[model samples]
Target: MRQTSIKRLYLMEVGSMPEYQIPVVCYLVQTRDGKNILIDTGLPETIPQEEADFENGQDVIQQLSRIGLTPDNIDTVISTHYDIDHAGRHGAFTRAKYVVQQVHHEDALSGNPRYAALRAEWDQPMERIQLVQGDMELFPGLQLLETSGHVPGHQSVLLELPETGKVLLTVDAVPFAEGFTRDAPLNDHNPDPEQARKSTLKLLDLVEHGQVNLVIFGHERAQWDGLKKLPEFYG
Candidate 1:
């Protein structure tokens, strides 16, 4: 199998927000060579003011254990953006090199107001982050699609799965199925709604052109229920 020979994808639900119980999830991607890469992360602790909380059962370590993985097993961590719910758990993957856009790193380090309460979670040592510009190929068949405007440096992941064909992890680029199909970005988190709308259209184009086989949205609880979970993976 090649570097992207139908990787095993695992969804780890780390935590969730209150009321709606919007889940905070992280994805684990294992290439054919057994390289483990993580995508996004849940909150490190919790933000009461923001109404963020972790269920006792949603421990990151425990979630990894479900698939027989440890923090040390991850080789890289990818951040879709600097949002607290998506990137705040950077501290969990202690040994993995973090892969994020250069602009995000700068904004995050400067303590952007969007991440003010979550700033402390971005304390990974400088050496751990590998910053890139624009779109980047992380592996032979894995690509990072920079679809900013939810935040200036946001991105999404795309992979050529052997069986599933093209798998697109929409991340925050499209928060849910409705947003993708309707090109509607939730008002609250879209730093620039105009850009957000355009970026989402790019993703839809991929699907319209029959380039994507599956799409996993960032925090779509409804969609999450219909998809396979850890231990039950897609290749």
Candidate 2:
């Protein structure tokens, strides 16, 4: 068996929503093999505060530079989903191969005006995009969870670190830790509430059976406030 080796996991708060009190987060996962995997890209730099609040040195590129990296240094860019808050800076990393779910990508490109805003960011050259059908291991220690409901093909992450153990990132699948339970009510963001609930239940089961050590929600204000941000990593 291949030994899972992850060096660091950096949580980056690239932007925030004051009205809802949610933090827009992105993760930078560094592997022992020197791979930089960036999961989700926060809002674009040109975004107005009316949509999402952002400050200087908070964009994807700026955040990378803080850790002695650039877009070129990123080996893979994973799209949890193509929401405006999650994929605005995706186009910037032209050198990185993009990973996303097939269903989600099709839905985003299905002539829906809701996703039209950031189509340019995600609709890159086909050669650069790797469409995944279902759950699979992206790397030795990194696993992708297909937890749709928040969107057509929204997915989450299950990452294993040598010291930190298993870390589950339920990105938008269950946006808040308070709502992570089986009986938690679904929010309006879920277009398909039933499917969303099933996804959440699946994740809950994984936590119980898979021995998950840390769980990070999508836009949870309280959780984000307590987590270690970039430069300070969890490994």
Candidate 3:
């Protein structure tokens, strides 16, 4: 008889919006081999009040310790795209290799204030960086799905869990379940509205056809409230 290893998944609550108090989260995937894979690093400990009202709740690295791990435990860091909020805390996982879209990496360093302002987090010197050009499988059963619309290099993640089935972390691709239901555009200060809309529909189609078992949106307050947060493993 042979035995198989089981993987676990958790959602780390990084912070929340000041106004109305919304959640900012990131995914933590613990592989069967004890390897840690981080989806996105949430907000920094503090953000500029002038840009947006927010509170950096818990430290992700600290949070990891609570689960018997540390920043050094992270083996890979995948950024769906480099927006201020999504790329804010990548600096913490210094021991992990960064996997990002080549285009997004370039844009973040291209001096656009939106991303440039958060340069310290993403631009710092690092090695073992993997800049992906398109969708890829980071590992078996864990795949990156490109849904670029809200930004040029946007992507989503899909993980096949033995107990939980198919789980899709939509990040900013869908924004919320509401967008998927109505085929509505994200009122997310998108740079390209047309592209955002088109990409959103593609995601909706995946859900409609039953390709995804569960979908987790980026920063939807209502949806975030109902999810199983960190310290709670999905699979």
TM-score of each: 0.90, 0.95, 0.91
Strongest candidate by lDDT: 2
The better-scoring model by lDDT among 2 and 3 is 2
Q: Taking the tens digit of each residue's C-alpha lDDT, what string does model 1 give over 1-235?
A: 2346447888777777556756678888888888888888766565545543544237666778887888889888988876767776677788899898898789877867877676666657889889899888988888888898788889999888777778899988887677876536345657788888878888898788856878989888888878888778887
Q: Which residue pairs clash within candidate 3? A: none
Selected candidate, larger TM-score, 2 vs 3: 2
Q: Positional deviation of 49 in candidate 3, in angstroms?
A: 3.3
Candidate 3 lDDT tens digits, 1-235: 1222328779877887768556778889988888889888887766777657767878677778878888888999988877767878898888889988887778777776778667778875646678888778778778777777788888888787778877888898777677775557455578877777877777677677756778888888887788788788898
Of candidate 1, the 10-residue stretch with the lowest lDDT total is 48-57
Q: Give lDDT per model, in order.
A: 0.78, 0.88, 0.78
Clashing residue pairs in candidate 1 (N, C-alpha, C atoms within 3 angstroms): none
Kindly indicate the candidate among 1 and 2 with the higher TM-score: 2
Clashing pairs in 2: none
lDDT, model 3, position 179: 75
Give the Å error, residue 228, model 2. Answer: 0.9
